[model samples]
Target: MEQVPLNPSRYPTVDYEEVMNSDEGVRKWTDNIYRWGFSLVDGSPATPEATEKLLERIAFIRHTHYGGFWDFTSDLSMKDMAYTTQELGAHTDTTYFTEPAGLQMFHVLSHTGGSGGASLLVDGFAAAQTLYREDPDAYNSLKTVLVNAHASGNEDVCIQPAAPFPILSHHPVTKELCRVQWNIEDRAARMDVDAATLVKWYDAARKFNEVLKRESMERWFQLKPGSPMIFDNWRMLHGRSEFTGKRRVCGAYINRDDFISRYLLLNKGREEVLGKI
Candidate 1:
């Protein structure tokens, strides 16, 4: 069965204060993130400290080379393109890691002297499902073919997963669709597969990319201070529109294990919460 594409507008925003104080609010907020793969928090304190606190409210931040709680702007301090004033296509973060960050939070502190910079989010699960129904061969190719990715912009540092991973991954125990890893910008040029298989994989990847960019599958919105967004990195691809001004953003990553433990505990004994991830 094809999963319905996510529409952030349909979900209600939960107040940060309520979430921090009430169990019911926490349930609603967590449920929104699990079901829709994302949630927006209202009435949050607009500061880097507040952003860190809000993320810690859910789970401890997973510290990476980028650091635990980031407050960055378009200064090119980092080697990645995210620090540049350019358009970034929809892609999941930490693709080069053996275990990618599970959840990502974003709080746009400020944006000035720019007209564009609307956020781009696409439901990768929905896009994959659509491709399965429309082109099974392409879907299967993505499911079976292994691809490599790397992060090597840093002068003396480089990162890549120990082994290549397929675009579609299923949980070993549950055999359920657990991840959708797709990042054209991060994909490595050297693939381990034969030329014939690599050709098929590229063709499949193109088709999958097309599906991901479909208008119906994309949710576009502008980020504002005091309103933060938490999204599942495993199920959604996030990006931004090109802009020419300074933009300050702060956020952090939450480990998959920590997030799942928190979710299961918050909704403990409520088997209904065990819906398809």
Candidate 2:
């Protein structure tokens, strides 16, 4: 298949045949279909065992209690979450984590009572690179800024210790640039800077954000009943469109290194068999 550029209007439907049969094929397919992520097999599994088997193939499994099975909740710590009355703005998950997980999978257990809750993905690596090329100083400033994210409620509900991280980072495996900053709900208190420098930094960040939003390079897809969406959490940022009614999803996070290792190991086994032939 010819490669498709990331564009919301021209997004292509990924065929199941290309995704489920083999690791190598899936890798190539993911490179093309998502250029950022992939949507895998959908349809009610024949049995619970099949569901477990499919889930096992993935690297991680996780959930959030604040959002129930059908909860359409936003990551409340970010300012963009405030602008969004119904939909989440584009962003990578867990920028606060010291080492953010590389991949994320969302299984759509059900989506009956809603409409317009589509998943939106943007190539953060691509966006950051664009910023680097167009505004190097701004990009550099973003890299140095230590973002602080926290919550003050119950220990379980509040983010502990106010995690701090850079706004941009190089991908551990691909070495590609990826955006690591998100929702400006909280600022790092530990970072001490002159008033003038702080204002300049915020201005630069705002400019970079405008560039990302105006680029029109986002891919949008709806997770309907039975289909699960798997994405490179490190490379692509994800968001959801607002919708009425209920929208429940099951999610899991797997280390990117783990997935790459599995992919490589499976390929090595194939190479060994071919050598005998």
Candidate whose TM-score is highest: 1
Backbone clash pairs for candidate 1 read: none
The top-ranked prediction according to lDDT is 1
For each candidate in the order shown, give its overall lDDT on alpha carbons.
0.86, 0.58
- Pull out the clashing pairs in model 2: 62-252, 69-248, 70-248
- Tens-digit per-residue lDDT, 1-277, candidate 1: 3344455565547899988887777777877788778888999988999889878877899998787899999888989988888999999999899999999999999888877888888888888889989999999898888889998888877899999998999888887778999888888988888989889888999999898888888888787899998999999999999987888999999998888877776876346556534
> How many pairs collide in each candidate, listed in order?
0, 3
User: What is the alpha-carbon lDDT of model 1 when measured against the actual structure?
Assistant: 0.86
User: Which segments of model 2 are wrong by more than 4 Å?
Assistant: 1-35, 42-52, 60-85, 151-163, 171-179, 185-190, 267-277
Worst 10 residues of 1 by lDDT: 1-10
Residue 1 in candidate 2 has what lDDT? 22
Listed per candidate, the RMSD to the true structure in angstroms reads 2.8, 5.7
- Kindly provide the TM-score of model 2 when superposed on the true structure, using C-alpha atoms: 0.72
Tens digits of per-residue lDDT for model 2 on 231-277? 77776777778866655555556666666555554545657646755
* lDDT score, candidate 2, position 154: 35
